[model samples]
Structures are given as C-alpha cells and as structure tokens.
Target chain A: MKARVTVTLKSGVLDPQGQAIAGSLKSLGFANVGLVRQGKTFDLTLDETDPERARAAVADMCEKLLANTVIENYAIEITA
Target chain B: MKARVTVTLKSGVLDPQGQAIAGSLKSLGFANVGLVRQGKTFDLTLDETDPERARAAVADMCEKLLANTVIENYAIEITA
Candidate 1:
C-alpha cells in the first residue's frame, strides 16, 4: 500500500518561509497572491497490504516522529 | 481561491531526509515502512477568485522558486 502524510503548521503560527514566498510572488508580478502556508508531505510505500493497517502505522509514525504535534497538523491518505 | 502545490523529488534521486525518517521509524519499531520520499506542500490563499488564474500563477511560482525543476516535480490543486 501507498500512504501520503501532509504536515502543516497550526494557524496563527508565524511562517517566515511562506511570507518570503508571498513576497517573491508579488515582486514577480503576481499581485493576487495572498497568505501562503508551507508544509511537508511524505509519500511512503509500505510493505503492508491492508489499507487500515497501513494508515494506522503511518499515523503512529507521524505522531512519533513525522510531525510536531503541538504546532503542526498532519493528515494521512492511503492508496492501495 | 485556494491553491495547493505539492513538490516531490524525481524518482532515482537520493533523499537522505526520507532515509533518515525511515531509519527513525525502524528504530521506533515500525518495521512495515518501505521507501519513503519526503516532499513539500504549499497551501496558498490567493486574492483572485478565478480558479484557472490561481492555478496558473501558482504553477509559475513553482517553476520559478518553489521547486527545483531539475530534480523535483510539482502538482497544483485549486479550490474555490
């Protein structure tokens, strides 16, 4: 099975990288750009075949290491 | 409009970050994990209401700065 995990910063947390990107966009003539929040994604190919088991394992991984639970939120998507 | 851009490393590229994550998982007792590729996701809120324009602008941003075109591929998603 294949699983994807997206980790994003919690709202209200300062994102300097996103701000820089937004500024660069404006400088490059893309004035319509607004708030930008950058995040991380992990695409994992697991040996497990069960979607349920795979998702559970990945979720554990996220909680234990992939994400900072206090400041970041993570979502998991499973594809068999 | 809201747009999401996911940037991933090209296949065959060495991803030490992903490798480190995988190693950590193993140390933490999650042995089912296989190949892991780490990537970036940017969630953008644009002033433009048109989905088409928002996606195009985000794509341009990806090509110019968000992604290393030589070794990364990006996918854009637009939401109104």
Candidate 2:
C-alpha cells in the first residue's frame, strides 16, 4: 500500500517559517495571500498489503519519527 | 477560499532528506517502510471567493515561490 503522511503545526502554535513565506508572498505581489501554514508531506510505499495495517504502521511512524506531538499533528491516508 | 499546495521532487531527482528519514525509520524497526519521498505542503486562505480563480492564483504562486520548476512539481487543490 501507498501511504501519505502530513504533519502540520497545531492551532495556536506560532509558525515563523509560515509567516516568513506569507510575508514574502505579499512582497512578491501576491496580495490576496493570507494565513499561510506550512507543513510536511511524506509519501511511503509500505510492504503491508492491508489498508488498515498500513495506516496503523504509518501512524506509528508519525508518532515516533514524523511529528512532534507537542506542537504538530499528523494525518495518514492509505491507497491501494 | 482555501487552497493546498503540495510540492514534490521529480522522480529522477535526488532527495537526501527523504533517504535519511527512511534510513532512520528502518533503524527504528519500521522494516516495511520503502520508497519514501518528502514534500512540502502549504495551506493558504485567500481573500478571493471564486474557486477557479483561487486555484489559478495558487498555481501561479507555486511557479513563482513555492516550487522549483527545474526539479520539482506542484499540485494545487482548492477547497471551499
């Protein structure tokens, strides 16, 4: 199965990187840009064949290696 | 309107960061992990109301700021 893991900063957290990007966009003439939040995306091809197990494994990967749970949240999507 | 921009490296490009992550995962006992690729995700809220215009604007942003056309590809998804 193919799995996607997205790790994003939680609400109420300060994202300086995202703020910098937003500011750069505004200066570059992207006037309508607002509230930009930057995150990480990972695509993994797992040996697991079952969607349920693949999701679980990916979620475990997130908790252990992909995300900092104190400030970030992760979502996993599985595709056959 | 809300938009998501995901920027990923082209297949033939080298991704040292992803390779490092995959190696770490394997060391941490994630044996099933394979073919990992890392990408960036940006969530943006635009003042524009039309979805089509929002997507176009986001795509332009990708070309100018978010992605490197020489080695990366970007996908824009608009959600109302």
- The candidate scoring highest on DockQ is 2
Q: Is the docking of candidate 2 incorrect, acceptable, medium or high quality?
A: high
Write down the worst ten-residue block by lDDT for model 2 chain A: A50-59
Isolated chain A TM-score, each model: 0.96, 0.96
Q: B1-80 in candidate 1: lDDT tens per residue?
A: 89999999999999999999889999999988899999999999889877777778889999888999999999999988
Those runs of model 1 whose alpha carbons end farther than 4 Å from true positions after fitting are: none
- Candidate 2 lDDT tens digits, B1-80: 89999999999899999999999999999999998999999999999999988988898899999999899999999998
- List, in order, the clash count of every candidate structure: 0, 0
Model 1: per-residue Cα lDDT over A1-80, one tens digit each: 89999999999999999999899888988888899899999999899988888888998999999999999999999998
How well does candidate 2 score on lDDT at residue A31?
99
- Worst window of 10 by summed lDDT in candidate 1 chain B: B49-58
Ten-residue region with minimum lDDT total, candidate 2 chain B? B52-61
Docking class of 1: high
Please report how far candidate 1 places residue B61 from its true position, in Å.
Answer: 0.9
